[model samples]
Target: MTGLGWVGQVLTVEITGFAHGGLGVARHDGRVVFVRGALPDERVTARVVDDRKAAFCHAELVEVLTPSVHRIDPVCPAAAAGAGCCDLSFVTGSHGRELKSRALADQLRRIGGVDWEGVVEPIGSSDTDAPQVGWRTRVRLAVDADGRLGYHRHGSDEVIAQTDCAQPVAGLTDGLAGLGGLRPGTELVVSIDDAVGDAAPARQIVQIAAPSRGRGRQRRRPRTGPPRVIEGGPTTLRRVGERMWQVPVTGFWQAHRDAALVYSDVVTGWASTGAEVAVGWDLYGGVGVLAGALRDAGVAQVWTAEGDATATAVAVNSFADDSGVHPVTGSTETVVTGLPRPGVVVADPPRSGAGRAVVAAICAAGPDTVIHVGCDPAALARDLRLFAEHGYRVRDIRGFDAFPLTHHVEAIAVLNRDR
Candidate 1:
C-alpha cells in the first residue's frame, strides 16, 4: 500500500478509526494513510509523511475540508504548534474524559493482555467530562541554539520556545519565556500550583538546577535525583494535615489541587473494610503522603517508607511531629518484604507499575487485604493478576479521572484474602 491515497489532496475520512493511541483500519493494503488534525464527519487534506506496511500511512494535516462538530479551538496553542505537545489540542475538552476512560480499558486489554473488558469502571467528574484546562504545574522545555527558552518540536530536535503555557500555574510563567538563553551550560525547570489561583499567597520554591555540556570528559551525569538540576530540583515541602512533605520540583506531586484530599478520603473509606489488619503498609509512600492520611484517619502502626532522601526527611519530621506515625526509608520491594505483616497494604506506585519483588513480598506476607493506586490501567491489570495468582483476590477496581487529557487515568483496587 503505497500511494498518497491522494497527495496534498484532501480525503473525507468518515471519522471512523482508532486502536489505542495508534491509528487503525478495518482492512486495507497498499495505501498511504494520513491522520492528525482530523475530526469526525469532516473531510481533510493531508500530506504524507511516511508510508509503510500494507494498509497504513503517517500524515500531516494540510487543511480540513470540513471540520467536525466536536472540533473546537484548541485550548493550548502548543498542542497545535509544538511537536512535543503535538496532541495538546486533540479533540474537544469534554472528550478528554471519554478518551481517557477508554484508553484505560484499552491499555489493560491490549497492552497488559487482559481479556476481561470493563474490569474497571471509570469515575468521572459529575459536573464535567474534562479536568481543568491549564496550569500543568510542571513543564520541561528545551533550550534553543541562541540559548533561548522553547519547546522541542513534536518529533524532531527542533525548538519552539514559548514564554507562556495555557496550562501553567498562576504567577509561575511570569518571565518564564524571558529566562531562556541561560549563562551557557545549564538547564531550566518551572513548577507551579494552579490551585493557588492568581493573586493568592505564594508557596515554597526550592531552587533550579544548572546543566552541563553532554558527552564531554568533564560531563558526568548527576546521580539519580530529583528531575530538576539544583543538584536536583529545589527542595519542596508540602504539608498535608500535620504531616509535612519535602518533595523536589522534579518529584511527583498530584497535579490537581484537592486531589490529595480526594485520594485520602477514598483510601480511608476503603480501609474501613477491615480492622486489626495483620499489617499496615504504605507503598510508594513518597514522603508518606498516604501514611499521613492514615494517621489522620486514625489508623495506627503503619510502616511508611519512601526512597527520596528529602522526601524521607519530610516523612520523618511530618510523622515525628505527630509522634504516632512511623516512617522508614528504602525501596518498596525491600519495605514490603521486611514488613511485620499487616492485614492491609496501601500503595500508589509509579506509572511503569510494580515489579516482581513487591509482588513476591506481598505474596510472602499474605496480607488479608491490599489497596493499590495506579495510573496505568494496563500495568495495574498485570500487577493485579500477579496478586491474584498469589492468593489475594481483587474485590473492586475503580478509576479516577486525574489527568483529564493526555490518555492517562488513575485507579484504586482493593484486594481481599477471602478468609
Candidate 2:
C-alpha cells in the first residue's frame, strides 16, 4: 500500500524488537512500522499515525493482543492517558533497564561496529520501594490555552494538563496549583534542590518564559528574553561529593538528582586512566561539573567550554578560587581549535550528539584519551563510528538509567588513541 493509504488504518503485528526512541519494531506488507506503547515479543494492534515515508510508518498502540510478562499497570494516570513524561512506565523498572541495555548494545554494534554486552545500571534512591518515580529534579512544562500546566503529547504540540507526573522529585509539582494565571503558551521551568539531610532543606525554583511571538503559520522566533523567576531564588544549589555549585534556575543542570554525582564519578574514573594528563578539555561542559572532576583527578589545567553565557558565568564563579580551571564561553567546535592541546578530552554533547565536524576536530587535536557522553544511543553510535574513522578505539562504555520510568538513558564511552 502507498504511504497515505496506511494512515488511520489499524493492523495487528508481532513486535520483534525495540527501537531507540522507545518504539516497537514490526513489519507489515514489506514496510516497517514503529509502534508506541508496545513491547518486544508482543502482538499489538496499532493505528497508523504517520506514514510520510514509504519504507516505514509511525503508529500508536490501540490494543495489546499479547502483552509481555514484564508489562504492568502504569504508575501515573497521566502516563496512562498518553502524557509524554513516562513512556516506559508500563514495564517493570528492571525490565525497562534491560530493554534500554539491549537497545544501546544494538546501536553500538549496528551503527558503530563496536560490540557491547553491558547492562544499563540503575541509579538508586532512598525510596527503595518507589525508586523509579520522584527522581526528576528538573522538569519543563507547557501551559495550555486554559492556563493548565502539563506536558505535550508525544510527537505533538497539544498540551496534556497534568498535576501528577511520576517522574518529578517530591514537591516539585506543588507549584502547579498556583500556576493557573500564566499566559497561554508560556513555558515553566521547574527545578528543585533535592539535597538530603537536615542541613539543606529542599527548595523549589520556578521560572516562567513568555509565549513565542510570530505571525500566523510562520516559524516562531526563539524566546529572546531570559525566564523570569517566580518562586524561590534566582539560583539553586547542587552538590557533587564535597563540591557545591550554585546553578542558575534558568541555566542547564542534570535533571535527575543523582545524575551529576554519578556522571562525575564515571568521567573521573575514565579520564584518570592512560598516560600523565596535564591538560584536559571539557566540551559542552555545563557549569563545569565534569571539568571539576578532571581537576580533582590531578589534571593541572582544565578548560571547560560551554555555549551558554549564563552557565559559563556560573562555572567561572564556581571555579574562581582555582585558576587552574578555565571556563570559556563559545561553541565547542569553534573554541576547541584555539585552545592548547590537551592529553584528554571529555565531550558531553547535546541529544543530537557531536556531529562529524566536531568529532573530526577532536580527532585532529590528537588527544590521548577521549571520553564521550551521549543521551541518544543512535547518535552516540554514529559519533563512535566517526571517532573510529579518526583512529580512536573504544576502551570502556557504561550506560546509566538516569531517567527512570522513561526510555531515556545516559551513556558514556571511553576511547584511547591507537599508538
Candidate 3:
C-alpha cells in the first residue's frame, strides 16, 4: 500500500453508510475509504485526497455515479462546493436526524462499548415549528486577508469567499450586509436573540470585533478585564425559558436558537421525575440559565460552577440575591469537591466532555442523579462508561436535532445511582 500513489487517484466505490464526522464510508481493495459529499447507498467516483497511513483513507467526491433518492440541490454553496460548512444539507432535516441517531448509536457501541439497543428519543417543543434553515443564534465569522467574511474551508485556514450564509438567524444574515464598513482582516463574533415566538422589539443584536493575534491557532484567551464591546454594550440579553440571560459576546451559549429552552426543559423534567432536590450542582453553568431552571423547579439551593470570569460575573449579576442561586468562579473538576454533596448534579461540559477527575468527583459526592449534556457523542460515550464504573447507570437518553441540517447533534443522558 505504501508503494501506491493514492493522491489524485480516482476510484469507484459504493457508499454503504456514514461515519461519525458526516463522511460516507466505502471500501476499496479491502481498505476503508471515507468520502465527503456522498450519501449512504450511493455509488460515486471519489478522488483520493489523503492516502497516508491512517485508520482509513480520505477521499473527496468527484462525481456521483448513482445518487441517492434523498439527495437534492444544496442551498449553500459552501456545502455544494465541499467547503465543509454543511455537507449533509442536501438531505432533509428529519432524515439527517435519523442518520445522526444511527451515528450516535455506532459511536456508543464502538467507542463507549455500550450497546444501547433502544430508541433515541427525538427532542423538540412547541416553539420550534418552522423549517431548520436560519436556526443559528450565534456565529463567528472569519476574516480573510482581502477583507472578506465567511467560514474557513474544510481542513484549512483559508477562509472561503461567500455571499450569504443560510444557517445563521435571519437577522444576522441581514446584519452581515451592513458590516462592510468594518476594517479588513478582523473577525466578528455576533449573537442574535431572535428565538421563535419573539417579537421584533424583543429581537436584539450584539457583536464584537475579536482581537486578532497573527492567526496561528485559535485559542481562547482568558478574559482578564472587561471585554471590549464594539457594537452593542458589554453584555447581550438572551431569552431562554421565560427568563432573560445576560451573556457576554465572547461567552459560551448554545448555538441553536431553541437549544436553551429545550435543554433546560429536558434537564428539569428529568430532575422533577425523581426525588425532590435539597441542593443541586450545575457544573460548567453559563450565565446561570440551567441553575435558574433548577431553582425554579423547587430546588432549595443551586450552586453553579463556571471558569470564565466574565460569564461567572454575568451569572452572579443575573442572580445575585436570589438566595437560592450561588455562582462560583472555578473549573468544575477543582471546584466541585468544595461544595457540599447534593441530591442532583447537572454537568454540561464542553465538547471534550467531563474528564475522569470530574466524573470521579461527582461520583465521590454520591449524588443520586446525574444529567450530562454533551455535544460530541464520542466524548459523551466515554464519560458514560466512566460514570457507570462509579455506580451510576444510564436510565434514559435523548438526542436533539438542535443543530439541524448539520452532523452535530446534542444529547442529554440521564443517569441514576444503581441501588
Candidate 4:
C-alpha cells in the first residue's frame, strides 16, 4: 500500500460532516475527502476514486468500521446501493431535516449574501417520528439499451436496474411497473395524482424521447403500451383543491405529494388577501395554481405566464370559469416585459434563478409587493441581491423542507418596494 495509486487504495478516515450532495466529508493527510454512503462521526474505510493532489479527493465507501447513532437500515434497495435516489436514506427524518436546515442557512449566507439567522421551518415533513418513505410523487424512469425500466446511478450515464423504489408514493411505483414492456431506449416518467385524496388513484406514465444525436430537440408522448410512438394526448388529470389541471404525464410538477397545497398556503399568506390588488402577475406559473389562488383572494385581475405551451393550455382550462385570470404563453423574461405594471408580482423560477434582465424589468415595473419562490438557495440569494439593488428589501423569508432526506429545499421570500 506504500506507493499505490488513488483507484484502489484503502484508507481509514473519520467522517466529519455532510457536504451539499449528501456525501460524507472527511479529512485525509490534510486534504478533504468526500465519501458516498457514509455518515458523520463514523470511522469508515474508503477507496479513493479521484485523487486531486492536496485540494480534495472523491472516494467510495468500502466499509464502515464504526457507525453513527443516526445510521439505520435503508428502506429501498436503490437508496441502499446509492443509486441516485436518496443518498441520505440512513438519516432519520428529524436529523435529515436538521442537516437540510443547516445547508439552506449556509447557502443563504454564503451565496445570497443575506444575514439569515432563522431556522428552516419544516412544512410537509414536520413530524420527526414519521417514517421517511413514499414522499416522492414524481419519479423519472430511464430505459436502458435492453428495454428495462430503472434509473441512472448518481453522476453516471449507465443505468441501474431497480425492482423496487420506496421514495415514490404507493400507487406511483405500481404505475411504473405497467410500462416495463417499453421499447428499447425509451425514457419514461411516472407521477401520481395525490390530490385525489390519500388513495391517490391516478397513476400516469409518459414516454420522453431524448434529443437526437445531433439535434437538440426532444419529443414527449403518453405511453399506455410498449412500442413507443411520438404522438399522444394528455395522460391524466391532476386535481388541486377544487380545480382539475390537465398535464402531460411527464410534465413538470412538484415532486412532493403535498407540495401543491403547502406552497399555495405559503404564497397566499405572504401575498396577504386584505390588501387591494387590482392587477397581479404570476411569473413562471404552471397550470395557474397561484393565479387561481390570487383570484380566490379577490384580486380584480390576475395574469399568469408560463414557458411551457402544454401548461399554458391547461392553465387556460383551469381558469375558464374565472374571466379575471389571464394566461400568457411565453418565457417569463420575455412576456413579463410587455404586460402593464402590476400591483404584485410572483415568480417561481427554476434552479438557474431569474437572470438580471428579468429582475431589472420587474424593478422597472415597480410592483408594490414581489413574491419570490425558489428551489435553489444560491440562485435565490443572487436574485435577492439584485432585487435589493432596485429598491426592494426582503420583508420575510421562510423555508420549507419540501424534499426530505436530501439537500434540496423550497424557499419563499417576500420583498416589499420602498416607497
Give me the candidate number with maximum TM-score: 2
What is the per-residue lDDT of model 3 for residues 327-372, given as tens digits with 9 covering 90 to 100?
9999898888789888999999988889899999999999888999
Candidate-wise lDDT, in order: 0.61, 0.86, 0.77, 0.77
Runs of candidate 4 with Cα error greater than 4 angstroms are 1-10, 51-54, 121-126, 175-180, 195-200, 211-233
Candidate 4 clashes between residue pairs 3 or more apart in a chain or in different chains: 112-381
lDDT score of residue 199 within candidate 4: 60
RMSD of 3: 3.3
Q: Model 4 over residues 28-62: C-alpha lDDT tens digits? A: 88788899888888999999988755577889989
lDDT per residue for candidate 2 within 305-360, as digits (tens), equals 89989899999988889998999999999999999999999999988899999999
Tens-digit lDDT track of model 1 for 1-419: 56534444444344444334423222223453546555445566666566544466666666777776666666666655664553525555565555555656766566544443342222323545333554355665556677776666656667776654555557655665665336332346666533332544333333234444454346564553544342223644454443455566656778644456677877777787545443478888877777766655456678886776667776777667576566778887876666787767887888767866787787687777788888777778788877767777777667675654444568887888856
The reply for model 2, stretches above 4 Å from the true place, is 1-4, 125-131, 200-202, 210-226
**Selected candidate, larger TM-score, 1 vs 4:** 4
Q: State the weakest 10-residue window (summed lDDT) of model 3.
A: 122-131
Question: Which candidate has the top score in lDDT?
Answer: 2
